[model samples]
Target: MLAFFIYGCDSNNKIWEVFQEKDLLKHPYASRCGDCHQDIYNQWKNSRHAKAYISEDYKKATHNYSKTKCLNCHIPLELSKGEKPQIRNFHKEDGVNCVSCHFSSQTNSMHGPYDVFSPPHPSTKDEDFRKAFICSSCHQETYKQWKKAKVEKTCQQCHMTPVEKKDLIQKFPFHWFHLAKEVYNHEFKTGKIKDLKVKVKKEGNTLLLTITNNQIPHNFPTADNGKPKVYVFVETFKNDKKIEEDNALITPKFAFIYNKPKILEFNFFEDFDKVKVVIYRKLSWQKKKEKITEKIFNFK
Candidate 1:
């Protein structure tokens, strides 16, 4: 393997050789990786992973960087190490960049789900990149919930849907020779309430509503920090006149159960002719709850 020394000066003005790997010397920054993998970089640029350190909500919640505990995950180093990575002083703003998950200290190479013949950087295929436990250190609560649910589908399979692409790299010497392949999208979108199943029924003077996390493997609002909530509102009407309304908030806390139905019951007047149930969700960092869906039933 070819190796070279890359010299750079830190804040202290002392020169340091950060990498002895030959290819790494050319691409030290995540932005440099974008030179070839433009599409993946753009997708990551719009994801929560990219804004982990710079998000306004996260900054406000951490009390303007007073909470050191939140820094580890926000500006993580090598995640493949299976430990809480130290916050990087250099490029701290990048937040969970391509190197965070792909870099391997042991092999001193980029680790990925696929074996790639990259001339710009040394790479190795690691199976751990395909597993969910790889994310447990950062997403502890969600990982536990997924484990309890005992589902076979991995986190990447659902969040990073695969697509057919012609080239993984751009402007390379072997670019034209490479064929199309299936690659996963890097957006990493989460928290979809569209697949949830809601059932409502009236029994005597009480209305029962069941909300099931049918498509998700974990809880509806799953996270390690921040208070994500699911709101259930019930309104009763009699003869076109508004009578009474009630609402319940479902907040997933530590040790919250996943992949189960949350049943809510509302008691209404016997003469009530109509009932309306509305579901709303608020992300932990969001200022307001957004309506997901609503159901109206007539008992008259």
Candidate 2:
């Protein structure tokens, strides 16, 4: 799971000294990395990881940043080698930055999925960087669901799939010349509707709808806060007139218990000539429900 990259250092080696500073906040911002890693930094700047602290949705959910508990993951000191992290006061606005994942206090060095000669700053190769456990501290519920599913793909494999890139870093005097390597995408796209296996059926007076997280390793609509929801809308029409409509909302708390098939049942009248079922999901921070899938049934 580990990947390697060469690092070139200047004779003075001022970067290593800064990395050893007690105040990690003093560490360079992601923008600074852009000087050398323009593409990667731009990708990170537009990601949720970059907006973890300053996002309006997060602010609303935490009641204007009053909840100290909610702030921990958004501004963690450093992710523990095992799980969880200690909160830090500095660099609150930076959210989950590069150093948060790369810097290791134990070894006092930058840790990544690489073991290369990085004399600019001490770098360690950590296989955990490529595993899902590294994300478990903040994504506790999703990690539990993934473990239950027993999927082979790690979080990084799915969310941070690798892409071929020629320039991993900008041209620097002492930097090693790298051809092309598979660098992980920092977009972190999750909660895709296409990943779910959904089926709807009519049995007697009950409309049974089944949903399975076929592709996603974690629970559907998973979140630590902001109240994500899954809506199941059912409607019956008689002679082109709407007869009955029923809907159900599945929240994060209940979605976590979705180890088994999420079968939603709705009782309906037999007179209906047609029935329609629609499923939609809204992220905790989203304002509108995005359609996942829908079905229509006709009765003779």
Candidate 3:
């Protein structure tokens, strides 16, 4: 429902300051996690999660919400230490630290404390701890949806597969790469042509423009809502005189078609050798307080 991430880093600075206090450091879980899941720990060290607090998006979103309450989830490690008492210092780049869910005391587990001091790191003898709960604690809604759909399989089931996961998990230099990789080409680049051509010509008082959807896998704007419109304008000035001005707007029929190429046609009469055309797919967002112009073509 929320527009995802959109806030500033007011809480981040406070989080680190609060974390430094003696009361907060009473619970030490990060060092324990580093001992067991050393490989995953090392991999996650450079991962996006490791820098969740520092992310510009997370910083902004947390600032807009109630600082005290939101900082608890935003900086779970400081909450487990019980130093600041209430949510305050959550704006630090280390927003979500390793101690968030990993701790030694069993009392800190679950929704209340949101702490787990002693989790089964890979170096620890127990390998069974690498189960779904590790991911479910944060992705509760998604986990619920998967459970209801009876597709709550192992992470490897989907993440390390043939059809969907082939490109991402292949052999590479490092055991794991934080950035996502793919075997198949992206949707936008799937069927794109090597060379694309567009030209316009003049015939007496009229102009002709041609556009080719050469290498596009689908269409120019191959999206859910395909309603596209084109506006053409022509103006002629001769001997310091505004001789004539004409404009035409056209809307395509396949507005709702899922995926397909679209060929448009337009013709207008004016004494000028140049004209302007614009195309729009949808309405602009009200929050975007600016005039947006899309001139498809201009010929002389």
Which prediction has the highest TM-score against the true structure? 2
lDDT of each: 0.74, 0.74, 0.37
- lDDT at position 267, candidate 3: 47
Tell me the lDDT of model 1 at 13.
Answer: 33
Query: What lDDT is obtained when candidate 2 is compared to the true structure?
Result: 0.74
TM-score of each: 0.84, 0.84, 0.33
* Model 2: per-residue Cα lDDT over 129-163, one tens digit each: 88999998888778888898887889898888887
TM-score of the candidate numbered 3?
0.33
What clash count does candidate 1 reach?
0
lDDT at 17, model 3:
44
Error of 1 at 295 (Å): 1.6
Q: Stretches of candidate 2 above 4 Å error?
A: 1-26, 174-176, 239-241, 256-259
**lDDT per residue (tens digit) for residues 152-175 in model 1:** 998988888887765776655435
Q: Is candidate 1 or candidate 2 better by TM-score?
A: 2
